[model samples]
Target: MGHDHAHGAGGNRRRLGVALAIIAVVLVAEVVGAAVSGSLALLADAGHVASDIVGLVVALVASTIALRPATDRHTFGFQRVEVLGALVNGAILVVVAVGVAIEGVRRLLAPEETHVAGLPLLVVAAGGLLANVAALLVLRGGDRQSLNLRGAYLEAMGDLLGSAAAVIAGVVILTTGFAPADAIASLVVAALILPRAAALIRDVVRVLTESAPRDTDVEQIRAHLLDTPGVVAVHDVHVWAITSSAPVFTAHVECDPEVFEEGRTGPLLDELGECLQGHFDVTHSTFQLEPAGHVDRGESSHR
Candidate 1:
């Protein structure tokens, strides 16, 4: 499992690097086109692409930090760094969207003579769309369960839609003298950004807060442990994720004294671990197997 996780992390890093490079290249073209065409929509899309560049950088750094080995000083190593990065990236998206929206609204109210070169705007936006599609394909195969990767994917996805909108706005501006089309497209891009950014922030916040894995049921876990042959009760049952895909569990189990006497506690513990792994997808677990009434004898250890 550890080896597989490491391999997956390496793949995610490579994908991020590729996507980042692609976005950086396209960003320059979009910026130049926006300046030359004086298209608000194109500029808004460029802003989003810029934010994606920042998001990718943060995701890459966090992915690297998350691979660090655990040490005494940091018991869980730097695994949570990815979650933090996701949160920061999400926040950046929201801020960028807001700024673009404000500018779009201003443009809509006070129409300006945008000397847009329609063909250039269309070609540039189409090129951006193609680049975004390539970046999306690179990130699509990454671990979707990872918040860090998901956040980056969300930004790329938003930019993809924004680029499409820019193409439409450019076409409309060229065919008809509709200057507000550019502002309208910028508004559309902002709309695409808001919800995805909010969701990414919520998910990362849940992880940073150490909430239980979304699929885990504490009551069900307790019941399963109680149904074990030697377990009489289950207490202090806690389940939380160390990373998006890594759930950790620790519990205290009251067991039949006869099982310990007969030297069967080891087998009982093995069964418990297997049950958790098979039924709950919880591979990392620590259980304190105590004979019935042992909790009363060691009050300090109960927790």
Candidate 2:
């Protein structure tokens, strides 16, 4: 499991690196464009792109750290670093969204003070949209499988929407001379960012709190374990993750006394392991095969 996780992290790291490069290029262009055009929409998109760069950097570093081998002191190695990176990305997204929204509302209140050059904004926004598209494609494959990658992908998606909003605002200003369109577009970008940020943070919090992976059904897992031959009951069944893909499960399985005394323990363990891996996609599992009547001193206190 560790080997497979490290391998996947390697691929994710490479993807993050490529996406980071793409976003970095667009970020510079957008920043300059925002300054030249004095367009709030362009500035908002530029700010989102900047956040994407930061997210990708965090994800990239986390993936690299996750490649490290487990040691005695850190048995899980650095897999949780990916979750931390995702949390940071989520916080950054919220900050950028709120900041952009506040400034956008301020600008909306005084449209006459907004002197955005529509032509420059349009050209830059169009370019930014294309770059965002490229970055999204680079991140698309791994987003569902890794929370860290998903955070980066979500940032890119936000950047894409922001660029699109900027483009629309530019067009409205160019054709109708509506200066407030830029502020409206910035608000739209903020609106797009908030939901995605909320979702990422929610997922990160679940992992930090050691909650089971969302796709996993704990009751079903317990039932499955109980259905194993010779297994009478399963208790203290715990499921959680170090990251999105690295789920871990542990349980105390009560079984018939003959199952342990008659040399059947090995096969039972094999069957349990295979069941978890095959049905639940849980590669790391630990089972304590206890005799049916045996008891641990403090077992009643456990769940």
Measured by lDDT, the strongest candidate is: 2
Candidate 2 backbone overlaps, count: 0
Residue 267 in model 2: shift from native, Å?
A: 0.8
Residue-by-residue lDDT tens digits, candidate 1, 118-228: 777889999999999999999995647688898889888878888888789879978996878878888888888899899888878778788887778888988888898
RMSD of 1: 2.2
Query: What tens digits encode model 2's per-residue C-alpha lDDT throughout 1-303?
Result: 777888889999999999899989898998887787665566667767777788789989988988999899999899999999999899988998998899889998887777888999999989989998999999998998789999999889988888888889889989999889888888988888899999999999999999999999999998888898899988878899989888999989999989978999999999999999999999999999999966677775666
TM-score each candidate: 0.93, 0.96
The local distance difference test score of each candidate is 0.83, 0.88
Error of 2 at 46 (Å): 2.1
Which residue runs does candidate 2 get wrong by more than 4 Å? 35-40
lDDT of 1 at 162: 82
lDDT of 1 at 177: 65
